[model samples]
Every structure is written in C-alpha cells, then in structure tokens.
Target: MDISDCKLLKVTMDFSKLNEWRTLPCPKCEIQLDIVLACGQSFRWTQLHPGIWCGVFAKKLWLLKQNEDEVMYQVFGGKTTDSTAELIDYLQLDVNLNDLYKKWAKDDSIFSKMVDNKFHGIRVLRQDPVENLFSFICSSNNNIERISSMVEELCVHYGEQIETFGEKTFYAFPTVKALASVGVEAKLRELKFGYRAGYISRTAEYINSQEEGEKWLYNLRMEPYDIAREKLQKLTGVGAKVADCVCLMSLDKPGAIPVDTHVQQIACRDYLPSLKDKKSLTPKCYDEIATHFRNLWGEYAGWAQAVLFAAELQRPKVKNLVCLPQGRKSTKMEEIAKVSEPKTKIKRKKIK
Candidate 1:
C-alpha cells in the first residue's frame, strides 16, 4: 500500500436516487462527519475532500459526504447487505445525542460552559472490538497521525483486500488469526511498530488461542463494565486507559472513562483542583478521578468526557499567557493564541 498511489477525487458525485449514493437524514449538529471522524475515536477515515470521507469499516469501503440536513454514502466493496442499517449502527444514530448533551450540560456546570457548537457532533464510533483493541494498543505513547499510519500498515499487510477506489485500494481490518500468524511481531518491528509490535502480536495470539476466538472479545459487551475492563487488561499492552477505551468505544459501556495525562490535566485544572499537583496517575488516583466524573456526568460519563476532551484538544494554546506575571504583556503568546483559535464561530445554543 503505497501512500503515493492514493489520490483524492477532485470532482464531487451527483446524489441522484438512481446512483449508488443514498442519503440519511441527519443534521450537521447531530452527526458532524468532520468532528466525529477526525476525533481520536477511530483512525480509518481519510478526508477525500473538504467534507467527504472515505474509510474502510464493517468489511466495506465507504464513501461519505454530509450536508446541513443529511449524510450521503455509498459502499464500494463487501457482500450486498443492508448498508443503511449498517451505517445507522456504525454511527450509533439511535443514541439521541441532543438529549445526552442536554443531560450532561444540566449535570456539570463546567461541561455546560465548555459546550461550543463547533464540538457538538463529537461522538464515539461503534467500532469492531478487535479493531478497537488493536488500534488503541498502537495509541499508547503515540499521536493520532502515527496511530493512523500503524493501523493502515496493519490493514495493508494482513487484512483482506476489498476494492480500489480512485488510485487507492481498500482493505478490511485484519482478523485475530491473521494478526496471530507467526512472525507477526518481527514483521511489525520491521515496519517500525517499536515495542507495541510485541504487544499486538502477543495479544492477537492470545485472542486466537481462545476457544471462542473473536466472539470472545465481542461477548465482553454483555459483561459488566468493570469485568470487561478487567478482562481486557489481561491481554498484553492493555492498561486501564486502553481497556476503558475499548469498553467505551466498542463494548457498549458508556460509563467507561479513559484517563490519560491530558485527561488528568483537564480533571485537575477544571474539575478536581484539590489533586492538581498530582504528577503521576496511580491506580487509586485513576479510580478516584474516573469515579468523580462518573458521579458528575452519570451513566454516559464516557461520552461527556469525550466531548470535553475534544474541547481541550481544540482549545487555544495560551499557557504562557496564563503563567505570565500579573499585568505583564506577552505579545508573542497572545499572537499564537489568536492564530490557534478555531475559525468557525457558530454560537452555542443554550440547553434548557
């Protein structure tokens, strides 16, 4: 899979009923493809154009574009199945995000203040458990760009080829057996996976050795959140954060909150000031912070955390200004902050 071979299609396709593209009536506020796809929840999506995204998920290559009212999509590969149903499930369209936002805002004042229209559509993607597990494994000590590249390499090396759109060929996410094959660790190391190569390879081997195999991983969705997180931690390279990510993103546990260093800062600065000086997140500290958030935001604490986390990520970098002595002027930091601010300024609607 040569990166140079993939080219973005310049021309937009017509959305006629006669064509393969079909529309799902979802407002931009409800399902903003730009925010949700680009957010750290999933890494498979690539922006083909400004508003158009092409990704491989659910064993199919998807071409999607959104407008103010609806999302138009077409499937290029995989069996002829009910793509509409698949899209609805993948996007978790049944989850009523407006109501959830309102609920979170009502409960947490900080969340209410942070609720900007620009980050409204940030929701978790219901990804495959196996893909979600492995992806997050690659996420440890890695940025989104690097994790995405690693995932692409994984798909290209082991996953089944689906189809080629434009100059790029698509491949489904690899199965546990495919990842478990001998020499996967060495090959991944050769691909510059670093220490995570062993984690992925060993985890895949462990999963493949199970009697139920991939089904065992998906079945954790039925278990309690605590149990599921515990079970996931048993696998190689899966810590509390990674396990919680799998639970929240794929295993139907909305209460699971992943607390990393960035999340620690968010918690200490805004919500938990008493623990602001804490340097490292111990198991006890992690549980305490997660519990506090769960109490503040209720059942869907994970979702609320995601919204705030994205807000923090998009927040202007002005810490130098904050740290400046009283009445002192820092022109350089101010200019950087102004430039980093989001261009879109749609006022947030009051949640009553």
Candidate 2:
C-alpha cells in the first residue's frame, strides 16, 4: 500500500480502445469540466491534459473532456450499462445554471461585478454521501492536497481495487464495514492520520451500528435540511460546518451554506460591513452569516458560495476555447504546448 509507488500509468494507455467515446450536450455556461472538477467540491478528479479530466465517480472510471457546447466521455470498469442518466444526475444538468447566474447577479451587486467567464459553470457536485462524509472529516484544519492524499490512502488500504492499467491501479472508496473493522484507529495513526484517526474510526463504527448501516446515511437525502444536519452532527468529529458540507454537497440541500473563516471574511468584507468588528465567529455569528446568504441567494445558496470561494482562493487561470479557427487544424504539438510551461526571465549579457 505504498501509494508513492503509484506512478502516472494512464499517460501511456490508449484511450480509444477501452470504449466508444460519447458526447453529452453540455455547454460551458452550464458546466465547465475544468473548473468544476478541480474546484474544492471533489478531490478525486485529475486533469490529465488541458480541457480533459480523468476521475472515478458513480462507481466507474471516467475519462472526460469538454468543449463550448458538449462533453465527451469514455468509460472503463464498473457496470457496462449506459451512464448518461447517471452523469446527468451527478452533474445536475437538469438545473438551469444560466438562469441561476442571472438571478444571483441580480440579487448581489458584488457578485454581479465578479461574475466572469472564468468563474462561470461553477456548481456544487452531487457526490456519494458516504464518500463525501468521510472526505470532509479528513478536511478539518487541513489543506486540499493533504486531504486528497489521505483520501487516497484510505482507498488504497481498505477499498477494492477497481481496475489495473499496467503497473498502477485504481480503487473505489472504502465501505463502512471495511473502515469499521478492528484496530482501524491504530492503523490510521500508523499512517499519520493524527487525532482525526479516532474521529474516522468511531464515525465508521457508529454508521455500521445503525439499523440499515450506510443506507441510513443515504436516507438523509430524504429528510429535511435541518433534520439531516442535526443527525449528521451526532457522529463523532462531525460539527456544524462538516454537517453543513454534507448537507450542501450530497444531501440535496442547496441552501445549506458551510461557513468557515474564508466565508466569514467574504461576508464581512463584501456584503455585511456591520459584522466586521466581530473578532471571531460565535454560534450567533455563524447563524447570522448563513441566514444572510440563504436569504440573499435563495435556495441555491451553496452553489453561490462555491463561486465566491473560488474567487477568494484565486484559483489559477486555465485556457478556455470553444473551437479553433474554421480552417486551422489541431495538431499533437499544439496540444502539448498548451500544458503549463515554466516562465523565467534571463538577464541577457549586455552587448559591449
């Protein structure tokens, strides 16, 4: 389970031979695969190349790419059934994103000014509740890169291997049973999970003790947002913010806004000048901020929060193009050139 040995295996594999690539009518205004995949919503997706992303979701390995109007995808491993409906549900393409953008712009003046093509198509991902719950548990006071590494370690150690491409392998997220087994905390500590080790182990055991086990977590989707949030907080290591994240990302509650220090700053600086003097976010302050955004952005407030978060983090810029000129044909060299190239200024020798 030494994950460092897992090199980039897909770089050499032929993508076309696994399955026929299909297209879904996904415009950039509706879905920007580059931004949506890399944003903090999910940690599994890797941008194998510019405008092309690879990830495992919905129990399948996916190689996905997009243009201005459509998304192209190829599938490998898992069930061989049609994934069109699954993809739509995961992406939530049924929702009118363009309409939401217009509504958000109309409601907040700062948002109106900040809304640009770069941040467009940013949305909350509908992820697996079990996976989402554990992932965010690993997120407390941690950076995204470390969180991703921890998640992968969880998979590599306990989850079933999904597929093997030459020397490297891909794994699905571990099941509650796998994580709840004996000595999970000790094993996790050995892997350097720190104090969060106890949290994850106890939480898994708690879930497994439920009448229906993991199904109970899925059933949270049907409960009221308040009820779901309250229930999730009952587990070990889960607090208000973690519960809110589960509610927003997976439990079908678009209005559940998870407020962290970053969000607190955004609210005080851009929208609520009155709250600026408060030194820290108390329970009353947290509710005040969440309630304000819920009222301001309406039901899809979580989605709106994602856009602001991306801006606050100052996510790196990526090249976006609909298509090449009518007569200009794309070449392999051009594609390779698009990858980030290091820029350095050299002091040229003065011609004496």
Candidate 3:
C-alpha cells in the first residue's frame, strides 16, 4: 500500500446527529490503543474499563475503545461539530503506518527484525507543545508511573475541572498563566515533585513571560530541527534528551531521535555493534547514535526510534538475585545481597 498514492481526508461530521457510540474504520493496521497509550509518550490517559481508555485532550474529555476493525469513541464534556476529525488527527489515522513500516524496513534489515510482528500500531502522537514540554520536563530521571502521577497532580492542583464521569473527574491541563499564578514550585514540592518542582515552575514562568507566549513554543514547528531543539534547551530543566522528545512528539520534527538509555543500548547491541565495547555514552557517542538512526530511518526517524524503544521495553530481561545456602554466607554473597536490596527509603532534597 503506497500511502502517497492514497488521498488522505480528514473526517468531518455533525456529532449531534450520530449515535453515542460511533465506529471509525482502521483497515491499514489494527489501532492498538493500549500500546499507543502505554508506550511512554503521552502520560495522561487512564484505563476506565477493559479496552476502554479515557483522557482529556484539546480541553475536551473523551472515552475511546478499540476493536478488531474499528475504533469506537465519544466526546463527553465539550461540543465539537467534528469530533471525528479531531480524533482522526489526534491518532494520525490518515497517515498510513504500514507504509512507514515498509519504508523503515527497506532501509535497515536489523530494524525489520527488531520490529517484526511487534508493536504494529505504535505511532508517535502529535501532542500539544506546551503540555508535552512540561510533561517531558517532569520525565527527567523519572519512571512512567511517577511521571503520570506528577502530571495528574499538576492538573488536579492547577487545572480547570471539566466534568465528573462516575467516580473519576477530568481536568484541563493548566495554562501557563494558571500554573504560574500559583506558587508552583512550592505547591509541587508539597505534592512530592522533588527537584523537578523547580524546573516546571521556572519553565512555566519563562513561557508565560514571553511576548508570544505559547505561540513562541508552537512556532518551533516551523523552524528546523536543530534550531527548535536549541530554543527548547534554553528552558530551565530541558536538556538534549528532553528537548528532542518535545521536538519529536510536539514540534513536528519527525527526524528528531531522542537518544536515552534504552535507545543507546539498542544502538550498541543492534545497529552499531562496534559501540558495544563502550561502557558509557559520552556526548560525542550520543550524537553519533542519533545521527546514525536519523540517517538510517530518514525523515521519520523519531517514529522508528519510538517503535524500537517500545520493543526494548517489551523485551524481557533476567534480574540478578542473591540466595543463601543454609546460613552459610560468603563476602561475595553479602555484597550481592546488598545490591539486591531495593532503595525504597531514599529521600529527596526539598526545594527552598
């Protein structure tokens, strides 16, 4: 299927005339809503039921379910004449991902094997820039579960309430002004945000103070990848990895490859076998890895990286454990036992 040959049209319709449960065909590849939502990209969506996930987007609350041939969805709180169009755009449904898979596979055989029959429906989301920026900033040195918790806390503390659905309530992602008006750092610290509290607070203040405000962030989509990344790096907590994430996910930079630990490991183990000897990835090595993938996957390198990253997450690994043999303990065993202990009591420094 040549995606370029197909005329991709946005879905537009009057939602009021339609039934509460409507289905949208997904013939190219099955829309794996679970994988797409859980793949460490956007972090706000929650599973309300089996195959049913709910989230707030564009200041509207929505519930969606996926089946074999179609996606079923409905808008809950807000009225939009073209909810289907919005959903199509949000999912990037018009873009043929199977075509992309074929292209990526043709370029790298290793990628072909790595992505073979796994994560077929994983797509990089076109997330809102402001929301994505703050979200990734909270992602530094954080796991997905903790990051989701922080984002939810931010919305609950500063965002506007949309409506209540059963026992769960949805809140709009807070505006820069709204986030800045509250003592953001103090409030976030109180919510156990740790050092990231300062980053989110300062970045929100910086964005709010800009003459163009959110528009300034959105305009990066028009800039070249490097220039946009440089501008994003200027934000308080944003580094190269975080900047690349926002660029790829929000700023319309499809070629931007975020080289994190998982990505670096993938490059060393699969793409660049010569790099296997290197224990730590220096800045030079990081750029080499990023450049390698960008050149290999072409314009949609970020999307390729995303699929590989999700694959890496799904791969199983053996955990090292220490066992004692009937009260006989050696120094080696003692050291391994210490290593096996989980750091659950670690304390975080408070922001002043």
Measured by TM-score, the strongest candidate is 2
Measured with C-alpha atoms, the lDDT of residue 225 in candidate 1 is 95
Prediction 3 TM-score vs. true: 0.82
- Report RMSD for candidate 2: 11.4
True-vs-predicted CA distance for residue 213, candidate 1, Å: 1.2
**Candidate 2's residue-wise lDDT over 1-352, tens digit each?**
1011111223444322445456777678888876677666776776555566667787777878877877767667787775776777788777778788888998888998877888888878899998899989998887666777788889889987787643457789899989999998999999999998999999999999999998999999999999999999999999989999999999999999999888999999988899999999898989999999999999899889988887776663433222333453445322432312222222222211
Between candidates 1 and 2, the one scoring higher on TM-score is: 2
Q: What tens digits encode model 3's per-residue C-alpha lDDT throughout 233-333?
A: 89999988999999998888988998888898899998899888988878888899999998889888898898898788783221212222344434432
Best candidate, lDDT-wise? 1
RMSD of candidates 1 onward, in order = 11.3, 11.4, 16.1
After superposing candidate 1 on the true structure, give the runs of residues whose Cα lies further than 4 Å from its correct spot.
1-20, 315-352
After TM-score superposition, the amount by which residue 124's alpha carbon in candidate 2 deviates from its true location, in angstroms, is: 1.1
Residue pairs with backbone overlap in model 1: none
- Candidate achieving higher lDDT, 1 or 3: 1
Q: For model 1, how does the per-residue alpha-carbon lDDT over 177-296 read when each residue is reduced to its tens digit?
A: 999999999999999999999999999999889999989999999999989999999999999999999999999998899998778888899988989877789898899899999999
What is the C-alpha local distance difference test score of candidate 3?
0.73
Residue 94 C-alpha lDDT in model 1: 70
